[model samples]
Target: MRYLEVTVPKGRRRAVLDVLDDEGIDYVVSDETSGRGFAAVVRFPLPTRAVEPVLDRLNRAGISDDTRVVVIDAETVISQEFDDLLDQHSHGGTKGSRTSRQVLRTKAEELTPAFPIYVTMLLISAVVATAGLLADSPAVVVGSMVIAPLIGPALAANVGIVTGDDGLTSTGFTYQATGLAIVVGASIGLAVLARLAGLEPAGVDIVVVAELQERVSPNVLSLAVALGAGVAGILSLTRGFSEAIVGVMIAAALIPPAAAVGITVAWGMYGAAIGAAVLVIVNVLSINFAALTTLWIAGYRPQGLFEVSPTRKPTYAYATIFGVALLVLAAPLVGVTLVEFQATQLKSAADEEVDAVLAEPEYNHLEVESTEVLLDDDYPLRSVDRVVVTVSSSDPGPMPALTDHLHEGITTHADGPVVVEVRFVVAEDREGDASEQIVHTSSGDRDS
Candidate 1:
């Protein structure tokens, strides 16, 4: 429910009162003592869903487009007429339960913050994320996401489009593009500084660090995160869910991948950098597409009759562009997913072949120890390059036949040519290897 305070302009008082009366609303009108253009102040309580309809009625009654009106949440209403009003609006079901466009726009603007603060905060977050990635700390990385002011622009653009607010639409896109650039730039700057200071270390492979690797080689699961964040973002905006919690989720999709772009750039890993950059772009497009589709389908549009056609046509065109671009960018992710599946399959087949070879009676004395898999260094798109198997034997004699047998078996199921190596370790029998001592019992040599 809402409580609206309307400033009824002089000579429009009767029209405004009549508009309220025809709708069976209960209002209290008091004279405006101030010598302003307004003659009286009218306050009325309404169900949340009825706000738009009543405002539209006021607009149609010759109230100027610039008329001042304020709508706020109503905690309690004690009128019999208010019960009837709530019942009247409840018939439309859940769709009518969403916050009005005006409230949504206001909330989005509030979330965005001033321009300078937005850029500064994002730069700080990027630096923190880059440091976290280098240090290989998951908790610190998540801390970076918590402080990101990203959700505002993520959802604001869609709200602007659906509500016919051009200013908001422009600001939302501008902020998103500019803010992302800022974060990525900050990460690069910090990473470059770290590298120059020798903090990257002489023997470290920074790009393949556990934390950084997650973003550089994104797959289908990455796309799913962005889409989910977007859906949750818009739903929170319209339905009063916590935007702060969802902001972290949205940042999770964008922040680390952006940081990956910087870390790779600093390390001169352009191949991996391109992969990470592509992931960031795909996630952004997916988020925007999801939010726009959900908002439009939820019946969010300009309430004015004349504004709907002009707004929706371009709005839908942009939506289509987002959809099409997502399809184009996401094609690579699908390819990456297939490669990953192939790699997993190859590993499984290699293990199976290793077991089959040692199962032979000639090699029965050898105990298989461990198998290691080495994959190619192709960014995002990777394939198995080599497999190493180690075995223990009581005899020291070399066996050249085992390597050939294992290679032939694995290569049959492999998608590409691969190298196989076998290493032998000699293990002599030793006494008292077990931790506990055993003694023969009187009955049947039972352990004591």
Candidate 2:
């Protein structure tokens, strides 16, 4: 049972009303023009499950994309006469479902566990994240995820906004932000301490192996997983489906990567840290958006009505904040797409150059060590300085065709001068011999 006072364009009022009417919603129309839009005061009894569809319909009907929907508290409504109106339309299958979505939202907000739980979860996550990184154990990482309390606040934040309850919104934000900061801060602190103590984990163990595999730009698929997790989180909270959130827990596994970011930073790898931090932001924003959408669709509203018009200053402030947050989250997603595109192009170019250079019939097993676009520290006109290439092999025989092929292929592909560095490792028993294999070596001057 949510009371909504919405303002839509005068042109779309009839269409909007007809949609509402078709859904069996009882609403009153008030004709009041404010600033740039017409205002309509609509009172309705709607189930939480039905809110999303209504919002989508309104959006399709060209209701101001910026249309303001404020929830009115029906608890203080002087009209006891509306009791029968509410009873007839109540949802019967779900016992608690019939309660006002606003009421449910308020209840959820007040359901914040004690501070002790926060502390406990923080320490547990830190320890688990650390052990996972050291031992390279996915099972330990999952165990840490299972004990994490992050799900509560993530779901709460979305519910708070959709329901238009300031208390819920603020509480949700506070809890999630606090938990995130604590976990990240602690992980960073611990990793840095470990490095100072010369306790850095080394080599490609299970944990380190996982870390190396995804050392690149995140894709749209990551965003989709986050969004799905958010939706699952909301369902778990509302429908008392606690087990459902476990899947959400795994889908948007936030802790391990965040801890990995900290570890990378401690190891002085700023690039990896940047990528990991972007991943964190991506997951957080996607989850929040998905959760907020779910709550709005559930028909949650703030209890209580304002006889006085809602303040313009605060309303616009919220819109501005929302717009900025959306942009901040969206900017990284766009950047990820661009980065992925660049990586694809760069890889293709590298492969073409390598293939053209190694045109010999017998020479094979060419591996590229690294590809970087050299940049001048000062000048804007600094183009790609040169292309660097490294090659390794067990076969020792010198081949003139392979060398000549590389020279011609690189010159054709690169915009600037291309420099190639080739190395041949002379090993007779390259078979099962794991003794010593020189994978890569960089030369300052290719001619050397």
Candidate 3:
């Protein structure tokens, strides 16, 4: 069966439709008015490709003037099963690659995931995400990602679009939007309470920030990751590949960023919170865009038993959505690039200082370790801390001047006068390695 929807100017709709009726075309009509013109939609399902000749006939009849017709593939006819499948898909059914019809048929035949399970999954996700942020454990964070029930509303929005099921779509988005709001709200509240009770937020570290910072760069990589995960998600939905989809969920990293934003806000880290918020937006936009695009490309359409008019309005609506999504996906990348350029400049300054210090004659075996780069000003020693000049050979002689020079050089190089503590170890010292050396100072050194 084939479905064809045509849009005609209001003035010629009645005449064009009459010609279609006389030709024995079965179709339905809908009238939508734009600024100054009316769109008459005519839909019909025919077994054969009989639309082209009819359109040619309409052109000869002068009805084709200011009219456009498009043919879209509707895989299966509408049925009770189809309606139910759309509901399930839109309302957080399992990740599967089933054609929209297959999904419904399977739902009809199999045990569906119950509402209780859905709620449980949601709670589990929220709890896990919370714990992951507090613990600063990437493993825990990824686990939270795997368990997030956030996909429900996003999928519902897509299903709603394809099937033109407004209620299901709106309900789905509402649930998601509300759930996210609640989760983020509770997290911020918890953080505020903790601060009020004189509790410190978790350790601020790069790894933790990496897990939490989503909105920083909505770049090509983010889009690719979301798209890849979306395919896996759809495949899991259609093919029962739950385990793979779970990993995809983790890689996609949807929930942690929002939780991070809440925690950051509680800690009074506005910049971090902003970054986290960006991450949440990027993930949401990327996931929805990728998922819907994949579904549409795979030929999932609304399963209404009745045919409706095909108008530019629906197509334009989709285009607009895509345009917005594209912009969202592009944001993070731009932000990241700007940030990286700034970081490179800072690192260049620090590196030049390190090289100058290394050139000093006293320290022959200078080694610099600075794998970490600090992003936040609140934590002073982020990526900038340096360990220079490890003892490479045995030295029986005291080298006070050399040690002082190293300290002085570092202080000058870094621009800001950082507190410097020096320690010494004999090159062949067996018990105390350079890392665990004892410091000898006139005013007693501090090392704990």
Candidate 4:
């Protein structure tokens, strides 16, 4: 429940009361008040659901500027008349619960803060994300996501489009672009510092840590995450849920990729940086596109008729932009996906070949333990595939012949050239027990 104290000019008292009465709201009017412009105070208690519509109606009735409206939380109301009034106005739907245009506009305006605080949070999040990515720690990465303030502007852009607020849209886009620039720049600076401190790998070769690799190559799955997060974010905002949690979701789709771009850039891996940048671009477009679509579907629009057409123009423009961008991004994602698919197939074939080689007569005592296919360092561009085979045996035979046989088996199924490396783990029987044996290992690489 909310308690509203509204002070309007004497001439506008009836107008305010009429709106309240129309909505079946009960109020107490104190007329002939001794204050500025001989104003009157209308004190009303209302349900939470009715707050937005009632406030919007009041603002539309031209009492917003001159009227001083203060809303206070009401713990309890023990009036039968008020209860009856609420019962009379109550509807069995979400029509009355939707956030008003004024409220949404206020929220958007609040999100576009002064430059200093925005920059501070951006730099801080970037640094935190850099640390997390370097350490390859999920917990640290999530902490950075929570600290990121990027979601505000992201949703603000959607709000601006829905409400036809040019200033809001411009502010949102400006802040979002500026924030991203700061984050990327700060991350690059951190990378430079890390390099100076001997924290990151030197030369053109990137250390293929799990976190770094994940962001450097995006596909359809990454787009799906951004789309879902975007929808979740707008829903949280409209439903009056916690923005912080939703913000984390949005940050997850954004921050790590941005950090990856900086890290790759600092390492002078421009090609890999392109992948990370594409991921970031795809995510940004997907989030905005999803949020805009969700808001439009949720029945949010410009309040006035004149504002409606203008709102739609920008909506279509933004939608088209995002759609085209997504299409452009799909090319790279599709290529990456195909490369991954081929790699998977190659790895599977190599594993089968290793198993077949182990089943041969001379290698019957040996078992194929594990197999992995390592792609070229500059994958998707250079197409060299390395098949590493790990095998264990109690009674080992000559490795040269076995390596040649394994290589032949793999190359038969491989679409391109493959480098086969056989790692032999010779296990000796201990105390006449074959199952429980002491093991000695020797590795040899044979390229074909």
Q: Global lDDT of each model?
A: 0.83, 0.58, 0.54, 0.77
Instruction: Compose the digit string of candidate 4's lDDT tens values, residues 259-344.
Output: 98998888888877888888888999999999999999977787655667877888989999998989888788887777778878
| Candidate 3 worst ten-residue window by lDDT | 104-113
**Model 2 spans > 4 angstroms off:** 1-103, 203-209, 212-220, 243-253, 304-323, 329-333, 345-401, 410-425, 429-445
Q: After superposition, how far is residue 333 of candidate 3 from its true place, in Å?
A: 4.3
Residue 362 in model 2: lDDT: 62
Best by TM-score: 1
lDDT of 1 by residue, 100-195 (tens): 777888988988889999998999899999999988889999999999999999899888988888899899999999988998899889999998
Candidate 3, 360-420: lDDT as tens digits: 7756664444412244342211233333333333554545665555455445534343434
* Model 2 worst lDDT run, 10 consecutive residues: 374-383
Stretches of model 1 off by over 4 angstroms after superposition: 92-96, 201-204, 394-398, 423-448
Query: What global local distance difference test value does model 2 have?
Result: 0.58
lDDT per residue as tens, model 2, 1-448: 4466678676787888988877666567877656576646555645444554565566667664477776543443334434543444445643243334534564465555566887687677866776676556778776777777777677666555555556666877787767766766777788778777777557312123554324223545666677778777776666656633544373335776677667766666666566667777767766776676665565444432341134323434544564467567656556556544554565467667776555545655654445443322111112344444555565555444555555555555555454543444444564754222322212222243
Question: What TM-score against the true fold does each predicted structure earn?
Answer: 0.90, 0.61, 0.55, 0.84
Q: Candidate 3 regions off by >4 Å?
A: 1-120, 192-220, 238-240, 243-252, 303-312, 325-329, 341-365, 369-373, 378-448
